[model samples]
Target: MSLAWNASTDNVGVTGYGVYRGGTLVTTVTGTSFTDTGLSAGTAYTYTVRARDAAGNQSANSNQITATTSGGGGDTTAPSVPGNLRSTGVSSSSVSLAWNASTDNVGVTGYGVYRGGTLVTTVTGTSFTDTGLSAGTAYTYTVRARDAAGNQSANSNQITATTTTGGGGGGKKVLGYFVQWGVYQRAYHVKNIDTSGSAAKLTHINYAFGNVQNGQCTIGDSNADYDRFYSAAESVDGVADTWDAGALRGNFNQLRKLKQKYPNLKVLFSFGGWTWSGGFGQAAANPAAFAESCYRLVEDPRWADVFDGIDIDWEYPNACGLTCDTSGPASFRNLMSALRARFGSGNLVTAAITADGTSGGKIDAADYGGAAQYLDWYNVMTYDYFGAWAAQGPTAPHSPLTSYTGIPQAGFHSDQAIQKLKSKGVPASKLLLGIGFYGRGWTGVTQSAPGGTATGPAPGTFEQGIEDYKVLKTRCPATGTIAGTAYAHCGNQWWSYDTPSTIGGKMGYSKDQGLGGAFFWELSGDTTNGELITAMRNGLG
Candidate 1:
């Protein structure tokens, strides 16, 4: 049998070639080709070639090639072909591939690699690392294995991969949320992104609530995603959204434009919110199908380029949020693992999780630690622990950073939640402390401090008990601080929310804790000057 391949290079140059039959070193040559004699006439054999430098450092084995003789042989059976080939890590200049090991009657010896239809190299292991490739190039790969008896197997499944354009979303990871419904009643157009200076500071944005339904990921609002047209004034650059040929019209197109100006800002389509979380239980039952549907939806051709990945926001896993979930304790872990496998290594996968840090509370409801391996990071919702949901009487700051004396609930503050999550083996670098850009308040309050008496939810401009920071700062001028958050009393109404000062303090704690970064509930709640966001960015630095 004879085998030939392109030469491998080192710091110096290729000096010679070493050939192997099955697993044993057979012969050495100073040329790129090799030939073997004295084999049985009717038998099968496998061969791999390796290059050696003048210094005697041997290169990895070359791609395996098999041949069968016309007569008989002592041990002529070939090993089974490699299977389950997939790409794991990838970058502009390199790609990493792995596969299931092949089995053989006489034991598999080595595996051969091929890239772009040409023999690249061979390896004794089941994985190969292809390096020194061009950036932004598309490559296809396959592998084969040989038995110790010198019998070669056929090619494995082919895998197509492309080098990433750049790298993973890096830097300090200043993530922010962009609410889809804000475009409607809130009138927070995508143009506000530029006006508020959010596009410049943000490294990634989560497009909120894509909606999980009927065990599949779906868009929360079709009109808001791709159909809502922007007027010339409302558009980011003062240009009207066109209905021209192949023109996209909604938030998706606007985000695409925002990313054009701020190329570093990656966006992920976040599916599921408090209202849409009921379907997550159903999703966990068939996670692979759910992941595939989500991948297709996120990569939809019309505005595929707008998003970098997907975010799973199951309100509570194995626990109750808006609806109860009976999916076992391992459900969240299984669901997330499937998502990571299906999404592959090229894109980011994240989740927005609950922050109930009390003993046997929301934190104990799911396997967040097990799921952490699959996530880029988690947005710890550190707010909403207390609000008008309980109705009358005691009023407390909804977003307390610390557990203050006389606090109504234990482990209901931001610091408690963050520390609890970190204790569960979640790296602080993979936890983004959540901040609310608005205030939660109560009406009919007499005392100015937190824990004041109140009748019911306050009369918000839009919602009953919630109002934007811009409005709350002036209307309910903060008169006191409790648990590291601000509160105020104006007439008979009382409200508690984070001001710029409190936000600075929170960001400082986030830095001190070595967190990934801070992510707020939304972008629209800040002042027109981007007050809270500016404080967060500077404090993080």
Candidate 2:
């Protein structure tokens, strides 16, 4: 019998609900609903519910209700064996599986997903994601259909899959953003990541900046995303793109090849960015419609296998960013719930969130903690705390790991941001420290120390006051270290950024803090030999 009850509130918070059968506890569930099987026909069962918290406090029992099974002899025949069990996707700590359903004399109650012959979990849905698994491990899986009368079908055909090298909450995640426009003036191609040895050390890549417009997820750049042709030399593999009608090309095709070379890496389509976050308000107003549109795009058949999931990069849910949103604090959680419902457990759902740690700031402007239940993890954008945007003076590091004596603002550092989110009930394991693979600078700085006054933003290759680590590592090497980062002043050009040595220090902090992993803003900023990524991999170990 399926049972549900209204949620009970608590001062701290209700962790779960305990369902009592005949005045005795039967089972506990986090959600308000429960399903009980294996009852005799025509029998009435009395049930009551009590709410519970993490500290073991329980609420008084609710009013009792009774439910009776149908008036008939108990079902005896088992369901047919489930057919064609298969693995849909594999990650470092999870496997997505699906199978054909089985019919029974009565009705199919649920499907039992088993791993290595052990019953893992039972779900009413046709698909499930087995999580909390070890990295680089192989596990065989099978499924069995269950009927209401307690009869279980024979095991379905078994399949095996190996997990990726690094993923999940247990392993260190190294995710880097691959900007779609990097192929233009940046002169960085997807193949360069492979040739530079960055791909092997990375666990996941976020294809940045898919647009969110008209309450839908749309392609950001057609040519750079999939239309541009690549020669054999520019391809991750030695194969060149052909003019064949359906031939895949561009970054999408190259990423597919990169995955073939490194089976452990997962890729996600990330929508929204600082400049394109304006459409998020409309998305928040109608989350279900937005999620449906995103689902269709991410699961499109043309390049269905190219992505494993979607990453939302809403700059601020109910606060100000490139544009302001007034959808209220609950909007973020509602949007995430919609996405999770549409994508199901078989696909990863994550988001890139703001790191504004100030009290009553952006962090407190949304229900991020409430939304945590739906996200696989969160990419905490811990950078951009202070930068050339300040323009004239008081130049500070764009990504500070900790507070300092003369800090420009309190709670504007990476540690503060992570702690603030944790205080709001977001698990530390779900947080990824953000790193900038570039430097922010100010020109006309006289003093050698960080507090020196500056005239304006320094000139850069692409944009003023910002330069890639590849250029800064050589052009303006580190001269001092502060707040767990590096800074340099060369010929009136004052710059601050993360070096390999500083990254090692930050990684130690990541381990000490029990963080999930670290992610960088972009890939093109690193050295041609992937010096920064190498440091990140070694440091995580």
Candidate 3:
């Protein structure tokens, strides 16, 4: 038999392809085509292919095709059902699944593992680690085997696994963002965090927008930062801020009390967001002074007890965010090193990074790997790969786990950027996958799938082309999913966002890839009941 198809391409060229027949892997060849002999005539064969590059990154399986021999005198019997399927162990985020091997007339190719009756993935081995499960949740798993002639066995005995209760234990973490501007029109205050039940679910909360100004970390909004008074009704614990001598007030005070309530919750003052990133270039010029200013401000005596650490959110060290920064590549490493030195090893030092997932993209413009040692772990802003920025958009999901066929751009997917970072020597355990708490859409979308023509940006509640997941979940509701993200098209609008189910898939991907954890853009984007955040915690736990 002979097979040939179009060649697969990678940013770093494809190294080889794995050819599979039924459950058996036939061969891994470097060429685009493969030929096989010794097959009996008149037998049916199912084939699929997977491409891998030098970096050890494998592409998703290709479309399956069928071929038949003329004689039909080959082994046509299916493999026996895999037996003794059992759960070896379970953790907050993962379950260990194993089963006895099956016998086939010819040879068993591999096994298919299912979770809750859905085929989550396929493996050549007898055991699989199902990751990104909610802690304390029960799950059912089954396995089946296949023969070379395209015959599949019956499902194995199902076993239930009850994951242990806990968040990502040890140094692993689940972090969330609480925006400073959320208090304005959004009416989402630090108090809302308690009401939403997010405080208990989070390990850390980044109080965003400690702006970078004049090459130093400074308060972005005085009124919202520590001046605005919260009424008794707006307070987190139902207690009002006092106006006595040496009285602590505003959101800063509320956050302090919140920490007291949730002993393990660490709040970090995040510096330099999209709008306030213009000062990063100046700060990079003198790393020490920048670090010193941050230390003093973050450790201010008035709110010293409030913040556990400093989170540098410089939009881009050597690239661009709100404004362009021409700082050299070495600047990011220098800034982070200085901050780490000043903050000391005991404090939690972190950074929110860019996820420009293209080859020679913004990620290549900075020295993240060199600076990884200085950070607890990087918050890889993996979302925002595509949006309705182009008035006439070839619509695509903002956060795609892998590139799909006919994708608009190359290297603009999550897995590619992640694989690039991994190839650049950034440890997977030090990288946290980013999830957007919102969706990007375009109006006048005629077709639903990606690469469809669109007229202009979709109308959003806050900004054009963007809307909260909470709103999109109801307004449009995901009609289809691709590359592990959810999308919906209602009337003239086409929206793409991560739903709970999609988030679960991403969480599984994170676990399989050995990522540290997952974090979203902001908390207010979730439902009032915290459904999305709950999904994240459940998947990552």
State each model's CA lDDT, in order.
0.81, 0.85, 0.82
Per-residue lDDT of 1-541 in model 2, one digit per residue for the tens? 8897876777756657888889877766666677776566788999999999859999999999999987755568999999888765555666667677799988998888878887666776565656557878899999989987778888999999887674332348999999999999998998888989999999999999799887679998999998999998888888899989988888899999999999999999999998888888888889999999999998888788989999999988888888888988899999999999999999989999999987688988999989999999999998888888888869788888876646788668887777667666677678888889999999999876677889999999999999999999989998877778889999999999999998987876675555788999899999999999998898888
Candidate 3 weakest ten by summed lDDT: 164-173
By lDDT, the better pick of 1 and 2 is 2
Cα lDDT over the full model 1: 0.81
lDDT of 3 by residue, 1-541 (tens): 6798787878846657888889577766655677554466677889999998868898888999999876654567988999888765555777667677899878987787888987655655565667658888999998978666657789999899887776543234678998888999999998878888888888888899898988999999888888788888999888877777777787899998789889999998999888998998999999999999999998989898999888888788777777999989999999999999999987889999888756578888999878988988888898888889977888888898776656678668777666656655576677888999999999999887677878899999999999999899889999887778888989988889999998987887776556788888899999888888888888876
Q: Of the candidates shown, which would achieve the greatest lDDT relative to the real structure?
A: 2
Work out the TM-score per prediction.
0.68, 0.69, 0.73
List clashing residue pairs in candidate 1.
41-71, 42-70, 42-71, 42-72, 45-150, 46-150, 61-122, 62-122, 64-112
Model 1 spans > 4 angstroms off: 1-171
* Candidate 2 Cα deviation (angstroms), residue 246: 2.2
Better of 1 and 3 by lDDT: 3
